[model samples]
Target: MAHQGFPRGLRILTAGEYRHVFDNASFKVHGKGLLALACPNTLGHARVGLVFSKKNVRRAVDRNRLKRLTRESIRLGQHRLPAVDIVVLSKRGAGELDNDTVQRQLHGMWRRLEQEAKRHLAATQSIA
Candidate 1:
């Protein structure tokens, strides 16, 4: 089995980094329990930021679990994603979802982000 680690470089660690993506996101994908916003970056790999607020998921353990699942999904699908900075925000009631269901939703969100990224790039290129 291959080991795939989620390195610090592939994360949005600072508030500024999160704000930058939020302010300049070029594409967005909406899901039942998740929302993904993506912006192209000069870095040659995709990076991710997670926003799981207490207001949405009151329990610390539940929030942590969601973050873990999100990071795992992103790490697994990173190769398929473009070089963009992505922010995944959890909506209210996300903590109520089962692990398998959350995993499935994350997978779908990743695929949608990829498609949206491609479409955004194509549209920009055509306009230019």
Candidate 2:
């Protein structure tokens, strides 16, 4: 079995890092109650940042739950993902979704990011 750990380097720990993804995103996608923003990276591996706002999810417990779900989903699928910096933001309805639904949505979103990042990278390489 592969080590599926969310290491510090694989996390967007700084505000600047998160801002970079948000400001220079290559692709953005929306699902049930989640929004995913992605930007291709030169790191050769994927990194992730998550946002669960108090305005979107009123309860602290709900926010933590969403973050845990997001991190777990990313950890499981990180190996198959392209080299990209991804930021996932929760919306108002995200708290209402069940664990299974959140996981399913997150999985689908990661898959979409994979496809989009591939295309974006190819296009950039062709131009350079």
Which candidate gets the maximum lDDT versus the true structure?
1
In candidate 1, which residue ranges exceed 4 Å CA deviation? Answer: 1-4
The TM-score leader among the candidates is 1
TM-score of 2: 0.90
TM-score of 1: 0.92
Report how far residue 36 has shifted in candidate 2, in Å: 0.7
- Tens-digit lDDT string for candidate 1 (49-110): 99999999999999999999999888765449889999999999999999999988888888
> What does candidate 2's lDDT look like per residue over 58-123, in tens digits?
888889999999989877655388888889999887889999999889888888877887787788
Question: CA lDDT, every prediction?
Answer: 0.89, 0.87
lDDT of the structure predicted as candidate 2: 0.87
